[model samples]
Target: MINADARWLRQARSRLRDADPVLARLIDDRPDFDPRAWMAQLPPMDLFGALLFQVAGQQLSVPATRRTLARIEELFDGRLPSAAELLNVEAGQLRAAGLSWRKVGTLRELAERIADGRIDPDGLSRLPDDEVIAELTAIPGIGPWTVQGALLIALRREDVVLPGDLALRKAVKAAYQLDHLPAEPEVLAIAEKWRPYRSLATSYLFSAAIEFSAAIEPAGAPTDAPLRERSTMAATRAGKGRPR
Candidate 1:
C-alpha cells in the first residue's frame, strides 16, 4: 500500500501541465494566480482529519459547519475524534453534535470501511483520479461531488471537474454570465479544455463564484457572512442534501 507521506506533489504538478489549454493557461500563467501557493501555506493535514472535514462540511454552510464540528470536538476529548472514538458515540449524541442521522451513518460507515481496509486513505493518494472516485463512490453516502472535493483537498488530484456541484455550476453561470445554471453537459463541455490543471481552474472559479453570489447581497451585511449558507439552503430546499 502506498503511504500518503510518500506522495510527491511536484511530480503530479508536472504531470498535470497539459491536462487542457484552459487549465494549462490558468496553471502555467507564471505569477498569474498560483492556487497551489495557498495550498502550501496550509499545514500538512492527515487523511483522517480530511475525511472528517468532508463529513462535517457536507450540505452545510462553512461557518455553521465549523461551529458544528467544534461542538463535535467538545463532545470528544477536546480534540478531533478518531474513527474508533466516534463509533462509541451514541446516535442520539451524534445528532446532538449537529450532524444529520444520515451523515452520522455515513461517517460511521466510512470509519468501518477504513478500519477494515475496504477503503484506504493512505492508498488513495497513489490511485488515478477516476479509480479513486470509483472506489469512494462505491461506499454508500459517498458521491461524485464528495469524492471530487476530497480528491482536490486531501489527495490534491489536479485534473478532475465536479460537474454536479451546484456551487460550481452557479459560479460557472455567473462567471460566463449565463442566463441560468449551466447544465452538466454545458459544464463538462467547458471543462473539457482544461485537462491537467482542471483542479486549479475549478478553485479559481469557486472563489470567483462566491464573489459573484454575494455581489447582490445587502450592503449592510456583516463580513461574517458565509457563502455556503445560500448554497446549502438552496440545495436543501431543492432536496439536494447529498453533500455538495
Candidate 2:
C-alpha cells in the first residue's frame, strides 16, 4: 500500500517559501499555515478502489453518486466487492446495485481487463504519472481527465492537475477573478507555479469554489445549496474523479 503520510507537503511548502517571492510574503503574512492538520483530515484509501470509484463517479452528481456507491457495498453484503467477486456478479445485479447500464458496462470492461492481466490494477501504485495515464487510458471510457484525478486521490501524487476539469477551471477563473476560463494548456502553465504543493493548491481552489458559490447564492437561500447538475465529489476517499 502507498503511504498516505507523504512528507512531500512540508518540503514543497518550504520550497515555495524560498522560490516564489510573493508566496514568501504570503507565508510571512500567515505564519501559522498548518499542512499536517489539513492532510490528516483527508481519509486514506487504496489505489484500486479509488480507480473504481473514479470510473463509477464519472458524470454523476455527488449525492447521487454516493448513493450508488453505497448501493455497491450493499450489493456485496456491506463491503466493497473484490475484483473476482465483481466478475462473478450478474450484470443485471450490478445495475440493480445502482449503476447505469453504461456504467455497468464500463466497470465490467475494466474488471475484465485487470483480471485477464491485460491491465494490472495493482501495478498502478508503482507507475510514474505518464505511465499511469498511459496504462489506465487503455481501458474503455477511461481518459486523461480520469487518470489525472486518480493520480491525485489514489496515489496522493503531488503536482498533478486535471486541466480539462470544468469545475477546477471554473474554480480557478472565479478564485483568481480571471476574465475567462483558461484552456488546458493555460491551466497547466498557471498550475506550474503551484508545483510540489499543487495538491494543496487544488484543495484551496476547491474550497474557493465552495466559497465563491456561496457568495453568489441568495442571502436567504437554504443551507443545503442548489442541486448541482452533474457534480461529483472532486476529492474522493479514493478515485472519485472530477465529474465532467
Please report, in order, the local distance difference test score of every candidate based on alpha carbons.
Answer: 0.60, 0.60
TM-score of each: 0.70, 0.76
lDDT of 2 by residue, 38-143 (tens): 3333334355555666666666656555667778877777666666778899999888866778767777887787788887766777888989888877766677
lDDT of 1 by residue, 51-130 (tens): 56556666666456656767777887666676777788887897898888877888889878887888777787788888
Give Cα distance to truth, residue 172, candidate 2, Å: 1.0
What C-alpha lDDT, on a 0 to 100 scale, does residue 218 get in candidate 2?
Answer: 18
Candidate 1: count of backbone clashes, pairs at least 3 residues apart or interchain: 3
Model 1 CA deviation exceeding 4 Å by range:
1-34, 37-44, 214-244
Q: Candidate 2: where are CA atoms >4 Å away? A: 1-7, 17-44, 214-231, 235-244
| Backbone N/Cα/C clashes per model | 3, 2
